[model samples]
Target: SQLSFINVQNRGNFRWPYDGLYQDEDGTLSGVVGGIVLSPDGLWSTSTTCTQTPNFLNAKTCPSSVGRWVRYAFNNANLAPNGEALFIYDTSNHYTIVLNLKKRLTHPDGYMMDLLTRQSYLFQFNGANSSVNLSYTGVVYDLVPGDYLIIRHNIDYIPDRVYTTSSSILAASSNTPLTAT
Candidate 1:
């Protein structure tokens, strides 16, 4: 038989997990440029590097002069998936979508975005309890309001560890429970 992805499997007999950073030259998820960002105050940006100002008050601040989003992503790969993957304090089981920051009380928007919008900053949820914990805590979620990610399964055809040319599923696969509620 002929194998489509020659290097799909490893000697350990486990399918190599996907890598999201392989999506582009700048190392972001597919269709999701820069991954959403959260300002120190409470504003969202398209990229980690803030271009918009977070003027929570009548304080109209300059885009660059104002506060910036903390930033977040689903994690791709690096020394250990620094800003790409989500997980339980350094575990191998990476979640589909997780925050780039860790151990902080700050969190992503709401849980509805994970299922309905597939993007955090896309939709605003009802109530003041729209926070998500990046960690496995109570209402506390691993992601913040600006966390960004798109459930793309194109890398399912990945044949090997083409780190420079391949990407992973960002834990959005149906196999594991991708949720923050």
Candidate 2:
């Protein structure tokens, strides 16, 4: 079978597959913006919607005031030595995706042992600015051959207000391969 990489662009008010799956009740899926689906070959894709809930009535909806990030797994064997993932946010009208290496890092105290490495990328879909390209980069960690890569997108709302967002992990390479490993 051919490796299928699912790509979803400009997800706002429309209901589409994001970050793996979608839930109508939890308005916080995929970080309130754009999301991604992956292929077996380590290729990534994204999507957007224009749907908003009653809680977000006062706030903006998809393709309007939201963006997202996706998480995928990376295998050391499949990547070049010190490989990097190049991320580009398609800012065709007023939309853009920003890349943030580490916006926030914290621990709950005793429960935490090793520091968690967080790499985040943001997608800004701004229709008013008319900007074209927004891009960023992330370095591949020293992962084992059987480990997975987690990819996510960060989004900025237009009004710059804090709201609740949600997301989920659909499928990982650890469970199933797009093709036989």
Listing every candidate in turn, what is its Cα RMSD in Å to the true structure after a full C-alpha superposition?
Answer: 21.8, 18.6
What lDDT is obtained when candidate 1 is compared to the true structure?
A: 0.25
Q: For residues 62-162, what per-residue lDDT tens digits would candidate 1 score against the true structure?
A: 23232222223222122223443232111222223333444333334211112212233232112212233122212212334644333332222332322
Tell me the whole-model lDDT of each prediction, alpha carbons only.
Answer: 0.25, 0.26
TM per candidate: 0.19, 0.20
- Per residue, candidate 2 scores C-alpha lDDT tens digits across 52-140 of 22222122233322323223222221222333332332323222232222211231110101101232222222232212222322233
Off by over 4 Å in 1: 1-99, 106-150, 158-181
Q: Per-prediction count of colliding residue pairs?
A: 26, 55
| Candidate with best TM-score | 2
